[model samples]
Target: MAGVGSEKVFENDKVIVWNFVLEPGEETPVHTHEHSYMWYAIEGAPLHIYDKDGADLGIFEVPTGAVYSLKCQDGYLEVLSEIGKGARVPATHKARNDGDRPYREVLVEYKDAMPAGGSV
Candidate 1:
């Protein structure tokens, strides 16, 4: 939950936070998000794909320190659920769905935040 509630702290056109690193030879399998994403590749090279229902959508390469935002409108990524709500992804630094795909990222979703004039 990140200790956040369903309330407005402020308003914005959009917001997201994340960090990622990849060792040589890695990729993140096709996945979906409910909010949206601006994937900023911090370190290492990564190959990203937008997929829906086990089908191919599009392929993207995110190099170190790059950013990309993905949404259902962009393509069909069979969204299973929303982020920061109830859907929980398996904590990384642990499992592997399929070998050869090792995309990693630190994610933060839009939610209630510090009020105005609040120090972060």
Candidate 2:
């Protein structure tokens, strides 16, 4: 288990920036997103996701230059399911690079935006 990203590149009172890179066939350790965050993809690839118990979730396509913002909230999965538009990044899960090319993204987590008790 680790933090939200592969490496913590920068951090201050307001936010934490992370560099997330996954080579082909590489998988990240189980991690949790407890704060509101956003990510900008540097490279596009298919990412396979699994729950903490190793249950398959699905393969998600990361579009090049795509950016996503997520809020930390209780019952986020339910909320996202109702919305039915954005990809749902689980509160606790692991991700594997399923494509031949590497998957890269820069993630910015808002420390101040962390929900009380880190629900997400």
Candidate 3:
């Protein structure tokens, strides 16, 4: 299966770190997030989203230096903080850079925080 990010930068028993980068007009492969994860944006951009079936979701703004934590189960994701509390979306999806500059982020997935019976 494809990873959730562009590249696997590091991994240990507790977590995996990824360096995700998207050039202008580039898109990632449809991927799944099975464990809880967090990401820090290095560069900001508007990202167009598509579900696993290639259905368009919408454009999401990613602000530089922003961070987000999410929990996943059965291909659905829930925001872990109060800022976007009660919101959930499909976890199996792809992101396309819809801006002129490259978008970059550092993502970390918590292996220990996986839902019961979950595996990467």
| Candidate with maximal lDDT | 3
**Winner on lDDT (1 vs 2):** 2
Error of 1 at 17 (Å): 5.0
What lDDT tens digits, residue by residue, belong to model 3 across residues 1-120?
Answer: 245577898999988899998999999888887778878889989989889999988887888887877887777988765444556779888889999999999988888765453321
Candidate 3: pairs in clash: none
For model 2, the run of ten residues with the poorest summed lDDT: 75-84
Lowest summed-lDDT stretch of 10 residues in model 3? 111-120
Reference-based TM-score of each model: 0.38, 0.80, 0.85
Kindly indicate the candidate among 1 and 3 with the higher TM-score.
Answer: 3
lDDT of each: 0.35, 0.74, 0.80
Cα distance off (Å), candidate 3, residue 49 = 0.9
lDDT of 2 by residue, 53-91 (tens): 999999877788877667666724322221224566568
What lDDT score is found at residue 8 in candidate 3? Answer: 91
Per-model tally of clashing residue pairs:
3, 0, 0
Candidate topping TM-score: 3
Model 3, residue 67: displacement in angstroms?
Answer: 0.4
How far in Å is the alpha carbon of 52 misplaced in model 2?
0.6
Candidate 1: lDDT of 81? Answer: 24
| Residue 105 CA displacement from its true place in model 1, Å | 3.7
